[model samples]
Target: MRFVRLAADYPVTVFGLTFEKLLIIGVIAVFLLGPERLPHYAAMLGKFVRSVRDFANGAKDRMREEMGPEFDDVDWQKLDPRQYDPRRIIRDALSDADPFAEPATPVVARAAVNENSAYLQRKRKREALGAGDAAPFDSEAT
Candidate 1:
């Protein structure tokens, strides 16, 4: 089975909460708590946000400490999940080894020989068939 990515126009979400959904939640909270209690709850929310921020900063600091100078040398952008593309990744991996380049080692030479033979076999089969003929199909292989 294959996975499909969402369309570009799809709404951005954070933990399944979109901007509209967050606005709705805020409105509901204001109505439920009323003006008198809203300030108290808002203050608590602010404290919670501050604590979360502090916790994240602390974790980052701890990681920096553990990683030492290497932490600053890291290419953080390359590691971001937002830029991920399975097709691009697979293409890059496949292209990393230049197939046409001279194989310096015995193992790579053998691989190139095998690949060339496979290509030749496929080419011969195609040439054996007429232009109008469909390629041979193996039901058992499927």
Candidate 2:
């Protein structure tokens, strides 16, 4: 994954494509389409992407309607594609609120610290084994 700064404010992580991968794609496009046809191909690709985006927005709107008044105030446009999952959102919203909400005790805080330390140790071991190096594999690869 690669991080890109949007509007110099928000950092978005993109899952695919590297500089080398982009260079290879450009080279292949040049070879296959030639200079004269490249612009037309690019325009077509842009249009296709726009159409898909429109279709997706339309589908989401329909889903929002089907979901009803509980989600009436939710703004789909503000949703982050990376962090948003509709089912999870709905599940969380529908879950029962704490009837007896109380301040955390010292024991609870100690237990949380112990759990976090154990998690950090496991994460360090995984990193040492190079298990975190796996990149997302494209299913379209031949």
Runs with alpha carbons beyond 4 Å of true place in candidate 1: 1-12, 96-142
TM-scores for every predicted model: 0.57, 0.37
Error in Å for residue 57 of model 1: 0.3
**Tens-digit per-residue lDDT, 76-112, candidate 2:** 6567475555665675577675534542333533333
lDDT at 93 for candidate 1?
76
Best by lDDT: 1
- Against the true structure, candidate 1 reaches a TM-score of 0.57
Clashing pairs in 1: none
Clashes of each: 0, 0
Which candidate's TM-score is highest?
1
For candidate 1, write residues 5-33 as lDDT tens digits.
54555687878999999999999999999
Q: How accurate locally is residue 119 in candidate 2, as Cα lDDT from 0 to 100?
A: 78
